[model samples]
Every structure is written in structure tokens, then in C-alpha cells.
Target: MAPPATQFELAQPPNDAISALAFSPDSPSRLLASSWDKNVYLYDTLRNSEEGAHGTLLRTFEHRAPVLDVCFGRDGNEAFSAGMDWQVRRIDLESGEQTTLSKHAAPVRRVVYSKEHSLLISASWDSTLHVHDPTNPSLGPLAIPLPGKPHAIAASPSKLVVAMTSRLVHIYDLSALSASLSSHPDQQQQQPPQPWQQRESSLKFLTRAVAAMPSDAGYATSSIEGRVAVEWFDASAESQARKYAFKCHRTAQPQTDGGGSTATTDVVYPVNALAFHPVHGSTFASGGGDATVALWDAEAKRRMKVYQKFADSVAALAFSPDGRYLAVGVCPGFETGMEDYSGEGRTKIFVRELGENEALPKGKGK
Candidate 1:
């Protein structure tokens, strides 16, 4: 259990808007954040949680171009990054050696590794997924085509969820992906594995982020519009009927016309990030252009906690392995009619150590 509501801001944060944040499954104190500034940052969460503590910057991995996402490999000693440079690279956390795993046709947006399956998967704007088994580098990666460019991808114990443009969502079985790589070379070359299930997104807008439930029951997806939908992997009609979507990260603002009359307008901000608690499977969190982070209970459909506003739009979020800490990445959000964007001076990362009962579902929603 963590101290009550004890939170601190990390020092030496990314110089650009954060693309993603990930915590090491093997080490609760290890954290990683990828940024548009062509770098991936490593931080020590335990050091930053102390009283009067600013975050501890552990190491920096510089890339040729902006890194879109990062994730822990099989252990805390390794990491993988997806890049705007159209490359997927693996980093040795100890020696800081970077190795190019594969180059995609377009920018790579997300990378997720499934330790259970020994697979490293990267989703790219090229509308394809490059699957690699880090343990067996000689076999090479297998490329699987997609219906749309993937924007976000995540891995559960048994499944892979890829959320893409035009409201496309695809779920792939990790075991199948693993088997394809280890099978005879001719079979893999003749045919690539297909998604186990493909479904149109429940949300109408472009999908922004996706997170797989630790329980492997389903996943939650957020969109450019301020909305989130939860769906289970079970294809049964009864299970599918339980799927739901909700509105969040929006505010009602009074609009003033040049003529002087004022009217209330609903301002909807993009839901930029979503993270599920590892300890409490039914509880998850979302951050948005509203610069706020909210916790919700999926089973109960209730709002649990809403942290105070950050300095800017919340770009990325991750729950620590034990679910005791939540890391939030903040930067200026790109709004309608904006001509320029930069997170250089304003980028920040906030880590909150939750109380034992803070994120636990309290009961059914009212």
C-alpha cells in the first residue's frame, strides 16, 4: 500500500508531448516514457515518491527521430521503442545498447511485448504489424496486414488489441502469433496469421488509445472525441451486449459571439490516454485534453476518483505494475484552429501513489 494521495512531479521530463508511458512488469519502480523529441526517458518512481521529492531521471535513449511509444521487454533489463523514423529498436537497459529489430514502410506508432508468448509486436502507419520473437532473432519478424493504420496497440496474457483509424479494432491471439514465427519458414512466408476477430469500433471518431485488461477479459478504447468504450473479448451475444461507452473529459463553456449574446457550448476534448489498474482489474483511468485524470470502475460503472487538473492536456498515462502508482504525462494539446504546437517548456510527468483503497471499486454506480 502507498501513502495517502502522495504525489510528485518528475524532473527532466520530455521536451515534447509524451506519446506513451509504460511501467516495468518486473520492477515496480521502473518507468519509461516516449516523446516527440526523439528520445525515450527512464525514471525511478520510488525515488520521486518521497517527501519533497522531484522525479529521478535514470537514463535517456536518444533516437534518430521521435519515438512514438515504448514498452518493457521480457524483463526490467530491456525495452523496445516504436519510432517516427520508421524503425523498431530494442534497447538494453543496462549497457544502453540499441539494436534495430526491423524497419517498417511507415512510422511505427506502438510496440508491445508479451512475455507469456515471447513476442514483440509493433504497429505502424504503414497499415501493418511486424511481429518479432525477441528470443529467436534468427527467424526474423512476420508482417501482418491491417485494414487501417494502427494508432494504438496493447497485449494481454493471451490477446493483442490494435486500435486504428476509421474506427477499426482488431484482436489477435498471442499464441497464434508466436506459433507462426516458430513454425517452418515456408509456411510463414506463404501465409501470415490473421486477426482472430475484427470489429468496428463502438466509438464513431478516430480511435486514440487502447489498453488491455490485466484479467484478459477485454479492453477499453478511447477516441479523438471525448468518449471511451469497454468491450469483452468473448464473442457471445450475452457478453457482447454488456459492452458500453461513456462520455468524459468534456466541459460546458459559455461562448460569446461578436454580437454580445452568450450561449453555452459543449467543449469535447480528445481522450488521449487510458490505463487499467493491474491490481484492480475492473478499475481504470483516463486522461484527456481537459488536463484531468479520472478513475472509473468498469464492473460498477462508477466514477471513483478525479485528480486535480494538470498544467496542460494529459497526453499519456500508465499504472505501475502493482497498481500503487499512476503516472500522467502532460503537454499542450492541439486544439481546433491551432496553427502551431510544442511541449518543450511545458511537458511534465506526475506520479501519484494511491492509498490502498483509493482505486478499489466502491460498489455499483448510482
Candidate 2:
């Protein structure tokens, strides 16, 4: 069967490339997208469905530099954004009010909020992770130094995972980290977080993205070399044996060799974004330079479905909190010359309604 059609496309999207897409935690119809144009946009996914119109742009939040990542607060009334300006800002969705939360020495790559712990985590290229309390912004954020520059970060209910450029993966117990911070408020100036476990990344290429499984079973990590790894938090031999990596987002080009024989050269495309279904933990979608979004069944160890290719690279992706829709951000990746991005280079975000069969894999017992 053919894949579902795009429910609606954002109207007048950013002129620059989109960097991230996030769904509201409390409302599935609300989505937030960040772009290199230095703006974060909020869209109501259902605004035009019945009328056959474009998605409504509810609001736009301005930033000093290119926004890289965005995440909604638990209430879904606030959003946190990190960007190239070395700053993290919070936006009041209803009032359009903005507040600076923290600053970094280098560009921040990603920001995540943990509703369970009431903490906001920001990972920066400066090789540090900052934890802040949105409720108490005046207290200043706690900084934890890293071994290398961080590329991606994801958090589950109980664990926070960080993937760095040097092929390093650090897993932290969120409950423990929150308890330690709360117990030693006085030592906030000197204490650094103790990671629950640290291991060299299984993939050899630079990590591009990491996503925590909704069930808190394990996490998935994708690399620029067109590879993805599924890893479990369990240290037991049976669980560890299930951890593995596979290649995707690639193609083979056939070339004539000196012997008049054709040889195929493998070309690798970077895996840019990944999002697991909020309800079906075993199913996750990956978008990449290949310009396609493919859903995978990690437990079944196979590709369930591959969506049609977009006009350009798929830069970011997000599954709605209710698992009813998927938001895809498409744009010319960094390889595109910025000089050609003026008049006709605007990027777009597409929301696709997911059917029950698509949301749940066969025999998964979700």
C-alpha cells in the first residue's frame, strides 16, 4: 500500500534550512520548528485539514543566531531553544515573551527537557552539558564537562544519554543526577555529574543523532557514515548480545574498471535525524541526506516502510506525543551553496497523519 499523504504543509516556511522539529508534549496538533534563519516557528497541524489549506503559523520566536534545536515544556505553553549564538532561550507560546536561560562558550547543538525531573539539558559544541531548572532560572545552570564535543542528546524517563564527536557515549541516571543536584545545592559551583556508564561508541563515524526509546528499554544512535546502532542499557551478556549496528541512507554507483568490468562504489549519506514512535517503542523513523524517511522495526531487525523522497535533504523529524502524526523538515543540507538560497530556496515542513497499522508493526503486540 502507498504511504499516507502529507496532512498539511507549513505556510511561508523559513528561508534558510530547518534545523530541528519538535512536537508539543501536551498537544499533538502543536509543533515547533527551528531554522538557520534565526527563528523558531509554531504551527497548528490541524488548522487546515478540513479546509484543505496550509498549516497555520501560530507564532514566530526570534533568536540572535541560527536556532539549532527546540523542545516544548511539559505544559506545552513554553518552548526552549538552543542555537549558534551560544545561548539558550525560553519562549512563552501564548504571550510571545522570551527569556534567556543559559549561555555557552560555543554554539549549542541540542536542548532537551525532562518532565519527570523538571530539568532542561543543553548540549554545546564547547564540550559541556548544562542542566537548568526552568522554574528557577535565577539560580544559574549546572555545567558538566565532557570528553569531546557533543553531537546529540536524548532522554528517557529514567536515563539521559549523550553522544559526543569522539565516538563517546555517556549514559546518566536522571533520577540520580536530579537527586545529587538537589542534595548539594551549596556545591553546585564545584560538583560535576558522575555518569552511570561511559563507553566508546559502536559506530566508527561521527555521531549525528541519538534517540532514547520511549519504553526506557534502550536507545538508538545514528552516524554521519550512514549507520545506525541499537543498544540496550542492560549490561548482561544476553542483553548486550542484542546490541548491533547496520547501514542505511546509502547507494551504490557502478563504474567501469580498467579490465572493462563494472565495479560498484558505495556512497554514504549522513543520517541527520531520528524519532521513535511515542506509543510504539519498537518502531522509529530516520531521515537523512538521502531525502527519504524510513521506518524501522528495531526488535524485528528490519525496515517496515520507506516514505517517498522529498525535494531536498530531510534535516529533522519528530513524532507527535500522541503518535498520530509525523513532522518532517526538508531543506538543502549544508552542502548547498548559501548564495542560491535567496528567492526560491525556502524550506518546508510536512505533517503526515499516521494510520494505526503504520504506527504499530505487525506481530509487535504493542
Candidate 3:
């Protein structure tokens, strides 16, 4: 049997459309959202303890324009936001202090940080990714060009990966990335004229190519094309090798639900946001436009359970560190399009546990 869809609405932002969202990685119950209303909100998931009391609103701040994305920085208490105004800003969750990093040439689409490196990455419509140090915004950004318009970006603290409109992913080594920036003229004064700075540097492309994941990976990408494919290149290799891999694994079925009948003929969905249990890396959840959240055996590429029937496209998904809960943001009836995002939106938290029937039909562990 499938897992029951247990949900709880967290909070409703006063925005007509919520375009970007994030839950605290360190504390999955805490949430931050940005919307067309030009405001940013922070909410706690467990605030509704008493019927008479509401969840705590850590803080809310108005932006100058429609904010595109909001994300946690290296620290859980600090958030970063980018938007239509072509600017990126950082907010301190505890003090509610906002700081503008720098103005982009185009609207900002995404902002991410690598806590281990104290680095922040932002992508913009201008087809550039700016690498910045969140602790200090006064420094210039190390601008990296993209093959096409970047729709989404993800990183693992030390590396940067981006999905571009051309169905490709650009992988840049953070160490090399930081080295490239150090060679910039602005950084020359601090480096004392290094010999490498005198040599002409060129734009280096990854030896390997990664495919774009359509929808279901999260709110940042679309899946109308059938599936989003990603390929990664190992920069450490002498030949710059590439590897083809599925970022999200979806079982295909024939058109069902009046769409089809064969399991082999249907398209595979893309993965939207991914949440690995803070304590258990092998367990994670993926939410998407299909209105279904799936629990996967991340390391083994196996499906453990499916949680379905969400009101709308999933905006965000997270797993608590204790591996006991799942949280998701849903925008009901809005999957048809984002134009009607204001209809009804809600955040739900589900209590999850390992199924007891792990008893396999033919296995020694069983």
C-alpha cells in the first residue's frame, strides 16, 4: 500500500504568487518564501500547537521588486534573495537585517550557498553566474558565462552545477572557480602580480555534458519535454571525461488516467527539489509538478513509497534531520499554469517512518 497523504498547512503568505521558496536544511521546520507581492516571509512549521495560537512569523521584509528566489545561506539563520530588480540581497533571520550584495545586469533567477566554503552563487537572465563571498558583499563577483539561459543551479558545498536552457549542465570546480577569480585584475593588488595572471585565460568548457531535467525536480525547471537528463564531467580527469546519469529516477508507464494505458509508453517525470535526511544520506524525498512526492532509496536508486494527491505543484520539500518528518509546500490547482498561483496555496508536514514490511519476498534479511 502507498503511504497515506498526511498534510498540514503551515502558513499563507499575502502574495498572489509565490515563485521561490526554501526550508532550512539544518532545521527543516523553518521556511522562507519569496513572491510576486514583493515581500519575503519566514515561518516555523510547528507553531500551531494550540488551536488559539498561530505559527511564529520570524520576520517579513518588502523587496523593491518581485523576488524570484529565497534560499538559506551557509548559516541557517541567514537567507539570500534575488529578484526582478536585478539585485541580490542577504537577510539575517535573527536580526532581520538586509544587505544588498550587488546589482546584476539582468533579473536574478537563483541564489545558492556552499556552507563549507563560505561561498554564494547566483544566476541571472543575463546568462551569468556570480560567485560571491556572503560574509563580505563589498568584493566584486567572479562572473562565469553560461552556454544558454540558466534555469536552475545546485551545488554540493564545494562544486557548482547549473542547468541551462540548451539541455546542458555546467560543472565548475569551486577550487578552480576561486582560483579564476583570484587572477582577476581586482584581485591582483592582493596577489602581487602572479605569473599566471599575465597569461591569457580562456573560457573552459566541461569535457563532459549534463542533460537538463524537465519538471518534478522542483519549481525551478519544467518537465513538459518528457524528462530532464543530467550528465556530469569529472574535472579532475586528465581527458575531462563525462558520465551520463539520471538526476531523478521516475518509473515510466503507458498513458493512464485517460492519457494512456501502457507503463512503458508514459514519460518519466523530472525531480524538483530534493531533501536527503540530514542524518541519513541514503534516504531522500523528491517533489514535483505531478502532485506526487516520492521517497527513494537514494543510493540504491530504488523507490520505497509514493505520497500522492497534492493540491498543486510542489514548491519545496524537506526532511528533518531526525528522519521522522517530511515537509512540503503545495500550490493547489496551479499545476495547469503559474498564472493562477493565487487561487490557494498551503504548506504541509507529514510524519514519516520506515515501513515495517521491509520483509522481502525472497531475501535473507527477510
lDDT of 3: 0.58
Alpha-carbon RMSD of each model: 2.5, 2.3, 7.5
> If the candidates were sorted by their lDDT against the true structure, best first, what order would they fall in?
1, 2, 3
In terms of TM-score, how similar is model 3 to the real structure? 0.72
* Ordering by TM-score: 1, 2, 3
Candidate 2 regions exceeding 4 Å error are 1-7, 49-52, 188-190, 336-346
What TM-score would you give candidate 2 relative to the actual structure? 0.94
TM-score of each: 0.94, 0.94, 0.72
The candidate, 1 or 3, that scores higher on TM-score is: 1
- Candidate 3 lDDT by residue in tens digits, 1-366: 745334555544534456655667687567777766788888776676456334555678789998878889865788999999999898888887888887789999888776667778898989888878776566777776665777667665455667666455555666666666656556534532111111110112211111111211211222332232222233345413332233333446655456555446544444455555444444456676566776654334456667755765565665554444565655543435556455333533233333433211122223
lDDT of 2 by residue, 88-117 (tens): 999999999999899999999999999999
Stretches of candidate 3 exceeding 4 Å from the true structure: 1-7, 25-28, 49-54, 182-222, 226-271, 321-324, 332-366
Superior by TM-score: candidate 2 or candidate 3: 2
